[model samples]
Target: MARRVLLWVGDEAVHEAAGRVLHSVMDAQRAEELMRSYGEQLIERGRQQGREEGREEGLSRGRAEYILRTLALRGVHADEAARERILGCTDVATLDRWFERSLNATTLSEVLDDLAQ
Candidate 1:
């Protein structure tokens, strides 16, 4: 005598449906393939985000350094403490105004004034 299996599709019970359709399927191998594909996709997305973050950091540092160098050329002398303050600033609009004033600022006070506004 053969064994029988029943599966409920909607409102009717179908006999031997799974045994007839999925009798030769491999479940473990298919699951492993899907897991590996998902891991690779996650790693690629993380790398792209890291690269973009690094690019933004480098641009901000470069702009800050340019402002300091321009201030030095214009005879605006800032000590180590003031230099640290300027480099720590992250606002782009404020930095742009400071950069413009650095070209003509004759004293450190004038440079700080531009940064304040």
Candidate 2:
């Protein structure tokens, strides 16, 4: 019943306060078990979120690299600042758009002209 009620609570602060209240009223051993279990769950959730974020960063990095390499192979001259701008971008959609532009671009401006607007 307590677990169900805790799940129903939308606010994290309120949920945590309710957990503390429940812990105070429970027997020591039971409270300890609840704490340990919830603690493990929270740690796992954090780890999962980190892994997901890392995966997204890696994907964006790969896309950026591909765009840079494509421009080089096509003989489009990108200056140091242009290289940095491409490498620094982390948004997948924006990288994809740039990559598409690079496929037929004859100059750096052709690939990144949208940024000027």
Which candidate achieves the best lDDT against the true structure? 2
lDDT of 2 by residue, 1-117 (tens): 765565456588996787788778998788777756666666777899999999998998899889989999999989999989998898888899999999998999989878667
**What does the lDDT come to for candidate 2?**
0.84
Model 1, residue 78: what's the lDDT?
84
Predicted candidate 1 versus true structure: per-residue lDDT over 1-117, tens digit per residue: 012122122223242343334344546565445435544555676798899987876777777788899887876778898788788877777777777777788887776664446
RMSD of each: 13.2, 3.0
- lDDT score for residue 33 of model 1: 50
- Model 1, stretches more than 4 Å misplaced? 1-26, 114-117
Q: Could you tell me the C-alpha RMSD of candidate 2 in Å?
A: 3.0
TM-score for predicted model 2 compared with the true structure:
0.80
